[model samples]
Target: MELKGIHHVSAITAKAKDNYHFYTEILGMRLVKKTINQDDPSVYHLFYADEAGNPGTDLTFFEIPNAGTTYQGKGSISGTSLRVPSDSALEFWEKRLSDYNVDHGGITRQGERNVINFRDPEGQRLTLISDETNQGVKGGRVWDHSSVPAEKGIIGLGPAKLTVQDPAPTVKVLTELLTFKQTGSYPSSFKGNEDIIVFETGEGGTGAEVHLEVRNDLPKERPGRGSVHHVAFRVDNEEELAQWRDRLQTARVPNSGLVDRFYFKSLYFREPNGILFELATDGPGFATDEDMNHLGESLALPPLFEHRREEIEANLKPLDI
Candidate 1:
């Protein structure tokens, strides 16, 4: 009943066009799925991933043009990091951000890894990191259609930073409930140089890492644009997913009760710090609906919402991608 690495990081974006351009045009990620939010058909639920829309490579957004900027504080997902291939990949990204006038910082050491930090157009905190084991190894699903070359393209998700005021309780949930082991502690300049505890899922490299930032002084966050809706951890198949649900119930943790998201099965529950966590399966991938060559070319709807496709389409703002 071990969890795999991060399946995806879903965040909020008020500006659909800006979010689309920043991720696809500037950052050069492939828009693998163009779908409406199943919970709210009025807004778009866009998925950006590697070439083939692999589970670990996906980074998604919920479009809410009127949603205000997020209030950053405790109990929020502070940062979403992307995995790059090498130190040279970081150099390429630094020049790429400069060329586009994107505000970013030079490469810095985060423990044993090198990270190039930046934000999306909507001020969503993001980073690109390369560890020694993953450096120079070309990733599994490098997008050929991306503006950035396949070699240097962002491969997948790295460590996601969660800001929690109380670390001990949250750490207990991570260790006991989720089965994440604390790998090490590193100094976090974001939390006034406080030590950030790093936890891992036993396998995978950068995608398996989760950093918990302990800062009691930070206030609670009000969710809006640039805030993470939830962080999903991967399970291998239906068998593994069922086992996870059983464990959650046994531990007295309330969950979303096995939701079928069409692309994957999900069970959502909030952790001790009130940050939303999801257990997502890795099969029935993005290509389940559309062909591999034309994954996000058109909007796809789930069966429940399929009857009102025209109505949903009318409500959603047109994306120029």
Candidate 2:
């Protein structure tokens, strides 16, 4: 019943056009899916991933022009780290980010890895880590459409950093309830953050791990653009998804039961620290609705929204990806 790895990390974006350009043209990821937000159909929910749109490769954003920058504090997904192929790949990205005038910091040591931290157009914290020593997730194809060469293009997710007041409760949820094993720890470079404790599940590396940073003095953050809505973990199939639901029940953690997300089945819940977490199945993926070669080319709606497609499409802003 162990979770495999990250299914995807979803965040909010203030500008759909700018977000699309930053992710597709600048970051060089494939726009795997372009759909409207199910809860609020007016905005777009855009998914960016590696060439094949593999489970761990997804980094999605919900367009909400009115939602401004998030208020930073504890109980939020502080940053997302991406895995690149090698040191040379990191160098390539450094030059690319600089050429585009994207604010970024030089590579810094974090335990055994070197990380180049940066922010998106919307101010979402992002990091790029070199996978030169094969320390990152292995699956997922290099994107062919990226302006950046395939060899140096981003591969998959790296560490997911979570900020919390006290890690004890979340630690219990992660280790005792969810089965993540504590792997290592690294002193956080952030001023007020304590040492970050690393936790891993499945074949560990990159997307298979979460880094917990304790910041007891900070206030709770409000959700907005640049805020992570939720962090989803990968499950192999329906059986594994059911097992996780049962485990949540046994542990007395209330969760959203078996949501049919069309692309993937999902169950959402809040971890002890109030950071939203989801268990999502990997199959019936992004390509389930559209042709792989032409994904994200047009708007996609679920069965419930299909009948009102024209109305929905008219309301949503045009995305020229």
Q: Which candidate has the top score in lDDT?
A: 2
RMSD of 2: 1.3
Q: Please, what are the lDDT tens digits per residue for candidate 2 over residues 109-205?
A: 7788878999987789999988876554585777777877988888888879999998899999999988689999998886756789999998888
Residue-level lDDT for 66 in candidate 2: 95
Candidates in order, TM-scores: namely: 0.96, 0.97
Candidate 2: regions farther than 4 A off: 191-193
- Global lDDT for candidate 1? 0.86
| Per-residue accuracy of model 1 over 1-321 as CA lDDT, tens digit each | 878888899999998878888999998899999998888889999999999989788999998878986888999999999987778888889999999998898788888889988887778899988744653223446787788988788888888899998888889888999879998888878546578989988474688878999888768998889889999998888788888889999999998889899999999999888999998999899888899999898889988888999998888777894
